[model samples]
Target: MSERFLTHQVENQPPSLLPYDAFSTDLPLREALAREGGGWAQAQVQAYGVLAGGEMMALGVQANENRPTFKPVDHYGHRIDEVEFHPAYHRLMELGTQHGVSGFAWRHADSEGAHVARAALMYLHYQADQGTSCPLTMTYACVPALQQAPELARDWLPRIVSTDYDGSHRLAWLKAGNTIGMGMTEKQGGSDVRSNTTRATPIGDGLYELVGHKWFFSAPMCDAFLVLAQAEAGLTCFLLPRFAPDGSLNAVRIQRLKNKLGDWSNASSEVEFQGAVAWRVGDEGRGVATILQMVALTRQDCLIGSAALMRQALVQAWHHVRHRRAFGRTLSEQPLMRNVIADLALESEAATALTFRVARAIDAGAFDEGEAALARVITALGKYWVCKRATPFVNEAQECLGGIGYVEDSPLPRLLRQAPLNSIWEGSGNIQCLDVLRALQREPACRAAYFRELLAARGGHVLLDAEILRLETLLGGDPTQLEGQSRLLAERMTLALQAALLIRHGDAAIADSFCQSRLGHQHGLAFGTLPAAAPTAHLLERAWPA
Candidate 1:
């Protein structure tokens, strides 16, 4: 019956790629986890990987399909600002919290490489959905900022680290767990918090009434937000909760939710604080300093998130090519397609290695001063380079699947939309480059740490060694010219570090290919530009084993 009715058969089309283990299948992530001192968390990460590739994958689609809706008022016209999400989003949040994606590092603070292990978990989850990562990342990053004010930490930190998901619209203290968000940028000042006009007046007892507007109020449904406002002493940091201490709705007016290009499942809003109640989180007039730690942690997440997206996109393209046939052979067997896939794999592996290495530095920062410095400078540059590369990386992956990848049903379009977000979210590329420069200039130890990392693999490859020398010569040049060259410096620094890590820990073929193509500039600008001598077959297998 089907033979007579059918106009064409789907013979060459690839089957769905879900229900696989995102962790076990990802050779780079698996290797990086153990290499970066997250070996102790292998079992936990493996279990979560199953769900990330299975249920969470489906949930991601459902959440995105049914975007969050803003309810600015109750049915009776009571101004009860609430954002409603599909059930899938709540379930995803529940799984994320239950699996310790947001709290693992804090819960295991005493453990060695706790941050690295947590980074691995978050990376896996980000492969499932980028939108959910916002609230989770803020919750994870807020711990250090909250600790700046012991009183606030004592009250909020417990709920933040709790492995419970309380999505109910209520006071945070009334819920078993909590999520935090950020309210920093205004229309007048995007990254420069000093230009903020929001005013905070002290009423009494370390409390302030804030009257200002936030241009980007992230995760409006979050239980609380870390906001920056101008106090009597100047710019200050405050804890603005959903409910005021008097057990009533705060004066936070939800102006409207942003119509974003991506992150469909998350709700970012423009908000107005009309005498909104808040508590100072850190010392007066030190808003930037207080939140800098949180920003740093979030920046680390940005890199990890970008790397995760790259991984998933590569996996999708690899899966498609291996199944879809063209020109009398599977697409994966074609020489040009092989180069593109292998090159994509090399980039993905390099990103994973660099990101996890930074995560280890973050973990070691607790006890090692050099590692702390390395985490500081490398995070900014890594975030800059990795996030900047994601959009192009994902687009290359989409091209592997041709027209189908551009459609909404395929994940490539969604991934491409998400790729540029991390770069823009915490701070744009220029801001990240300037941050790297600031660290290098103000912190001598940071410069030392950066060189130490580069020198570790100095003899690993000649191209890498030459690149390192070039960086040294460039850095030694006129200081006044450094700002103009900051982006170049950031890109080179990241590539050098990635090359070093690969030489030290990655497969020989991958290391050689990366050095020759990326550092030595032997390859062209596009994805399929690896040298003809490169081992494309072996690279693809290592990237995602058959």
Candidate 2:
């Protein structure tokens, strides 16, 4: 059965699906992040699924096309001119354990908290097949739909929440993972989210009717949507299942998928819901808070993904320079190339440090109101800097490759194109900056505590002196002081201070001072410092001089 399914390709072509093979490689921390996912991010899904035993489930299923026969190429080709179609393909097979390979379902009950883990695995498959980028919309839709019809949550959560593959095969295409990205963006809403124009009114029976269009949904063709709509009480969340039980498109229509620079593997679409059947997720007025929990998770995922991308770029650069020769020796031996590689390595490590630290904080439940706001702010900064640093590293790596890098076939250009999308997706850098500012304003005391943590981390005396000097310098009214008024400047200042504190106090041992210095330079960039030839001198003189 597994062989037959493995032989069954998408259409007549063999499967291009790569199994998660490098789960146990022990590379340097930063290098591992890049090679494992950052550089080859699309492959991370398989790794995640394998970790949760999803490969076993695939193995258990009989070889057959049980779902709808919709070709993604037909839908995508209309929008994208260039589409790569692999010739030979192979589906995901059994998980190879130390004992031997086994079907996915056989190992389903093996892991601790296996049920939840299984749901997560299923979710990933669904996301991969439908669209990977639009979990936000699907989550939003599911919460409300389940709340209104509690039975749906009870029935569906067990099957689909943990694993993306367990849902009804008939409605597989409409599940969270199957759709085009969910559309939540409105022309005027701008992430404030409370200002959406879409409306839902209670009709007859248990269904409420929906009407409105979303401007930017990641997976618009998803099985169901959790939409935000104006109601009699206030802005509320509605779960609009996109298809009937028989697997037909209901009232939702896909307007189009955006031509994006990154995450092109998934469709980012605009959609219209016309009298779509929906059930409420929670109390109408409490939609914002409920949605935010999901948004926070998405933000963390973005940060992790960005950090992974940075790691990938750095590793690729290292490998390129190590093997590629120029002049008389390897590019890595060149003084300038060495410096560039060192700098890239440092930034990647710093980004990873920050990301993992935040993840631990989240896991520890340290994200109180104040910490939550700051975490988001810091994560935004991390996402922005990791990707921002990665782009140049990729370009430099390509430069090392010279003409070969310029060609599309090289991974350098692909990394360069894909890395920038991280900064834009989740939330734009500017939006993150604004969010930080808002957070600071809302919790001045907590903001102050956060800064104190920063100051203490940078050596309290040193930061105190620097802050006083900075204030004194600004009293003379330098033109650059105008930048101090910008939200990003203030937020990044807080981040720098906090990072310095974390380094001083955090348990992670410093492996490379060269990496640390490069991180300092990157931090300066995050704070919008002017480019300088000597990064150490610039950090002392401009960023946090005592």
Query: Considering every candidate listed, which one attains the maximal TM-score?
Result: 1
Best by lDDT: 1
lDDT of each: 0.93, 0.47
Show model 1 residue runs off by greater than 4 Å.
1-4
For residues 1-546, could you state the per-residue lDDT of candidate 2 as single tens digits? 668568645432222222422122213332323322233332433365454233432321211112112233355454211212111101321112111111122233332222122222333332222123234324422332354547556654443333232122236434432321244577688676788888888886656788887888654444456667888888886666656444554566666557766544445666677777776767776666655554554555555555555554554455566666668787767766665555454454555556654443333333346454456556555555554555665666567567766876454565566667666666676666665556555666545545554555444334333553453344236544443464435434534543453355332333223223333332343321222332423222211112
Q: What is the lDDT of residue 34 in candidate 2?
A: 37
Judge candidate 1 at residue 538 and give its lDDT. 86
How big is the positional error of residue 68 in model 2, measured in Å on the Cα after superposition? Answer: 14
* Candidate 2 off by > 4 Å: 1-152, 164-169, 172-181, 188-192, 204-206, 245-248, 366-374, 452-484, 494-498, 505-546
In candidate 1, residue 66 scores what lDDT?
94
